[model samples]
Target: MRTVVFDLDGTLVDTSGDLIAAGNACFRDMGLGDLLDPARDQKTAVRGARAMLRLGLERAGQLDDAVVDAQFQPLLDHYARAISTHTTLYPGAMAAVDALTADGYRVAICTNKPLGLTQQLLTALGIDGRFHAVLGADSTPTPKPHAGHLIATVQAAGGDMARCLLVGDTETDAKTAAAAGVPAVLVTFGPAGADMAALRPAALLDHFDDLPAVVRNLIG
Candidate 1:
């Protein structure tokens, strides 16, 4: 069977607004000015919450590990409360996932988001049942940019790495796929910085609807 793995944050979901709100809330609680610019920081949100927090806190000179950790619970609380308040699947994300799953592809998620929150968001968005497996950063000993999680995901889906494809919007995802020996398709609409053309993915997709055709071409 073929397998397709997806990145959660920017690739599938437009979660930047919620993330920025959370960061702004954290800064507000600490009496610091907002340090995140949604336009500039949107891409960074795909790196996961810690990275977002680090970026904002560093700019405000408040990124001490202890202080950041101390603020973790509150930040999460704020985020959880507003999780879907500003989040939505990118255009065509749900349809693409559904079509891929219906076409007998084992669709799964491999994101750097924490397990609990990832599950929560997936469930909230009513897409939790779509994936055959979901691997969060905290779900394994190592996260993306490390092959363990991807390897584990492929194994769990009962598919060989050679028959699997990783879909994401970051260099980390490209590197992870390379390390895991799985071909990757980079999505241009996600949080990538350098031109995706430069990353030289197995394929580059501009829209979610383009996925099935790309996969067919890959596995044909």
Candidate 2:
């Protein structure tokens, strides 16, 4: 079946709020008191935990790889405690998923988030069963930007790589699709939405309401 692979943090859901909070929690642990702003640092948040840590450390004049490495686990712990606190589904997200599923397409999540945390977020959001497969950075030996990650996710979802496209919101996702020789339909609904055009994805999605049609145009 034709398949749609989605990037979790910035694509399907607005997870930036919770993600930024977790980054701030790490700073708070250092007695720094929330170095990252939940609103202004959203793009960095979706970039991943390390990105947030880097930004905070830079702001605090303490950008050190060792410090960031040390705080990684604590960040995850704090995130797990409040993973769903400010996270939310983007407008028409699930409705779009249901639309694709109903139209006989296979849908799956391929996120750079750790597998355990990805599971926690999806479960907390009550969306764990929505996809045929939910692969994270640790799910396989390789992650996004590597074709293996997307191909492996397609295999896990019982999808043919030749008949798939990615719905995502970052250049990482664009690179993943490019490396895998597939179309990338990037979403324009977050802090960096306008910037997605520079990545030159097969299509730019302004809203989930336009996704099913975009997918069809790209791969079907």
RMSD of 1: 1.6
Residues 75-142, candidate 1: write the lDDT tens digits: 78888888988898989998998998888888889988888899999989988888889988888999
- Tell me the TM-score of each prediction against the true structure: 0.93, 0.98
lDDT tens readout by residue for model 2, 42-161: 889999989999999999999999999999999999999999988998999999999999999999999999999999999998988999999999998989989999999999999999
lDDT accuracy of residue 145 in candidate 2 = 86
Clashes of 2: 0
Alpha-carbon local distance difference test for all models: 0.85, 0.92
Q: Which stretches of candidate 1 lie over 4 Å from their true place?
A: none
Candidate 1 TM-score, true structure as reference: 0.93
> What is the C-alpha local distance difference test score of candidate 1?
0.85
